[model samples]
Target: MELGRLLLLQVFCAALDAGTTWLMWSRIDISVVLARIAGAFLAAILIVLFCRRAPEFRGIGRFLATSISLTCLLVSYGIFALLMLRNPVLQWPLAFAAASGASLLLSWIGYWRARQGRVSG
Candidate 1:
């Protein structure tokens, strides 16, 4: 049941992210669409793997993971969108850096939270 919920949340987030990206660009490029699809696929796989490995991530821990992950994803996407709007040439590198940084920070937070939860209860 927890895994189901987590997977559902992942699907929702991925859909929202892709939809926002599509809406942001006036003219949709095939490369961008393909990239988003690939990213979404990878994210889904990661979520499934994490859920399987870290069964302790439930209740408040799960909530924290979901909220932080979603927030970071949106923020990263927003940064990318803003960069693309301002300066197209440097968008890819900067956006990738921002996304990568957010991912690392969020992963650490989730791991710490899960460990703390396990220790406490």
Candidate 2:
């Protein structure tokens, strides 16, 4: 897949995830857009690193992945905030964990499908 198309896909996924997080949370955080954009950028960098396109930038790719991961955590936190609104005194650590886990599962499914297409093509 072309890098440009991959980046677009990443942005699309991030945007959809962020939008869902907003709807689920009942509040919009402007920063989530920035985070999503940053996440997409970092995802591109991570791809380059993971694919071994640049050995010197491996550390940078790691940093980018860490940054994107942190942003993803924040996105999960936003979703958790939305989920907790239904119950005032609910502890959110577990909810966030579950949400993150679900998101990861979905991502893995999408990644698997994408890889299959690439391999079969």
Candidate 3:
């Protein structure tokens, strides 16, 4: 995708994360908030910009990938960040890895489907 769109998406996701954090947590911490926001921003970029045939963003696979990636990031980092900053949690890394893996797999699905002439946004 274009740099402007990408940046706007990131900012939008960050704002969402921040707003969620504020709504959920009575006492907000810095590291945890940053981590969640960063994870969301990263997820959006990975699923959208880096998806198969990308910049073009077509296909059900792309849509699924975006949802899967965003969900993984929000659930994993958003929850784990609350505890990980105070004490290390192995699940945090594992969850982030899972987010990455899911995005990659979904992107591959999109790629294969597009190759099969099945790219319809």
Candidate 2 vs 3: which has more TM-score? 2
For residues 1-121, what per-residue lDDT tens digits would candidate 1 score against the true structure? 5434544555555555455445444355554534554554455556545544565555446446655555555555555556655776764545556654665465456546655776798
Off-target runs (Cα >4 Å) in candidate 1 are 1-34, 37-45, 58-60, 102-121
Q: Clash pairs of candidate 3?
A: none
Range of the 10 consecutive residues with the lowest summed lDDT in candidate 2: 54-63
lDDT of model 1, residue 73: 59
Error of 3 at 47 (Å): 1.7
Best by lDDT: 1
* lDDT (tens digit, per residue) of candidate 3 on 1-121: 3333433443455445545544434355544445456546654565565545455443345565455445544554544554555556555445444544453444355445544565343
lDDT of each: 0.54, 0.46, 0.48
Query: What is the lDDT for 42 in model 3?
Result: 51
- Error (Å) of candidate 3 at residue 22 is 23
Top-TM-score structure, candidate number: 1
TM-score of 3: 0.36
> lDDT tens string, model 2, 59-113?
2333443334445445554565566666556654455456566555544444445
